[model samples]
Target: MAQRLVFPDAYAAADLITFAGRAARAGDGAVHLRASGGTLVTAAAPLLRQGLLDSTPTIIGMRLLPVDPELDCDLVVEAALLQIAHDDAEAVELPETAVPPPLWSAAEVPRSGWSHAGTLDLAVLAERAQWGMSAVAHALPIDPGDLIVQAVRGKIWSAPDEDLGGLPRGVAFVARTLGFIGEDAEDVGVRTCGRWTRLTLRRGHVLLRGPAHLGMTEVRETGHVAALVD
Candidate 1:
């Protein structure tokens, strides 16, 4: 089961508001913005007019069903604030009202394993590298491949083409973007939590190791590899 997130006051206002706007435009229903007393004074009016704010500002004894229940409420709130900052409301607030327990439980809660943590895909990473390299290519003489390797963290693992999703027990690439020791013209060492199995790759191969296994295609689309057992 995924864990439940109790939104803080900061999230309640800013993030919720932003999400409200996007959802409203998409016809996904309004995001409920609840508050008490004077907190909603300036905040509630504009949001209400935009139809982003729920007409009712009191969830005192009500329950909520988050579509992405496992999503970090804070992140959603942050996204919302980023979206609505240009609007009339400069700040968001949470009233002193009480919130009710969840009326309906989510089908599944987000898990707390390395496999469930955030990761990036090669393509997105490549795009980021392209953007960064474009910006500093003149000042810094570097290779795109080097930049991509530098961007990735932890360990990299590879598998036999047939056993891609099978159990992993092999040496993998270990690159460090943070706390980089020095700059040199040498391939970084590969590390792994398990033993190595004989596997063949084409000419060049990058080893990835985590409690997950993500393919190039999946990464390009979803931004990360598939999570596997640790």
Candidate 2:
């Protein structure tokens, strides 16, 4: 039998599906769903690795949704499949069918012990994200190949910005793309724990692993614990 996510209400279920769809359109189609106890952490990769040696930073857009305390799981599934499952269901339950995601998607961000790094204005984040998007659009040729697109994106997003806590512009790009940063001129929290950095906003969160972070190393060395602390 396929596992299902039982949300508290119809609105919550619909919200998760909508967020998943938005995330898929921004990046790849896969969304990682991990539920434990009363919280369901839904995440999608906005920046991804094209190959094993690809030095691109692993940036993920994540949202925390409420669910029934009894339901617990960890799996990756296609956002489109998730929406289809929701549409076919009669109640506020999301059915899951496992789909393997890219290897880099396996790198987990630390859940606890996040110290407040600093704060960034939402307007700044939005502007940076827009700039990166525009840069990629202007640099890509008409009908560009997949490799070329990835290369251009990697170069643009991976470059660090000293003004934004020395984080890559991709961080802002992911936050904006995932709809985490809103039109309000409020400041968002930046937190850090070990090699993981989290941008906390009212709508959702964006988790990022440092450039040196690798999926295989975390899986093998930490026994899949994803503890990348030095």
Candidate 3:
């Protein structure tokens, strides 16, 4: 098996992302070296684990490629939303770029590997992440926005017309979304958990409640959480 390239925690990983973005902004050798300090090394390790970039600043003879400004901005935004504190060293408020065409792609910078500490926190993070993910998607030339909607449909529809037999709408919705239910499942109300949230269906309604951590999904069934690309 290969090494994990893990972070002390997701929040720590986020701070490193901000630092790398700023360092990528630096060009001159003096400035670049100045920005590439202990923090930069600490941050790059997790990214290295994900195969996003090489571990060393200079792979062999040549220097590592600099991070794009727009990519940097988006990363800052992403980490900002997930991080616990606002005192990140590279807390520069870059403007949101409009019009399409982001300089980077998902291959160079992955969009996954976020481990949460709490259930409500993960739900809240997912809500915030939707907008960030949208920004990045809008910048993509392929324009996959339509595909995103086709994929997700797990919300409570209090006025639903179909016969769900008093199955808690939210719990069933999540169960279906997670691929735990097929179109023809019966009398089954689902119960599941995530990093910090517990979701259960009882009497046609879903209850979402949890404190945090414990890899909550271990308590639920998911066909697959991630898809293979390429």
Against the true structure, what is each candidate's TM-score?
Answer: 0.21, 0.83, 0.17
Tens-digit lDDT track for model 3 on 46-108?
101112331111100001222222232212122222222344323322323222222211223
lDDT of 3: 0.26
Off by over 4 Å in 3: 1-162, 165-168, 183-230
Q: Model 1, which residues run further than 4 Å from truth?
A: 1-12, 30-105, 114-213, 216-230
Off by over 4 Å in 2: 1-3, 84-96, 211-230
**Candidate No. with top lDDT:** 2
- Looking at candidate 2, the ten consecutive residues that score lowest on lDDT are 215-224
Clashes of 3: 9
Best by TM-score: 2
RMSD to the hidden true structure, all candidates: 18.8, 7.5, 19.4
lDDT of 1 by residue, 99-217 (tens): 23222111122222222212232233233324433443444445556334322211121222212233221211111111111232222221123322111111111233233333322
lDDT of 2 by residue, 1-230 (tens): 45567777777787887887787786677888887778788889878766875656778888888878887888787777664243534233444457876675687667577665677777888888898889999999999998888889888898887656678889888888777877766667676777887767778877887732221111112121222222
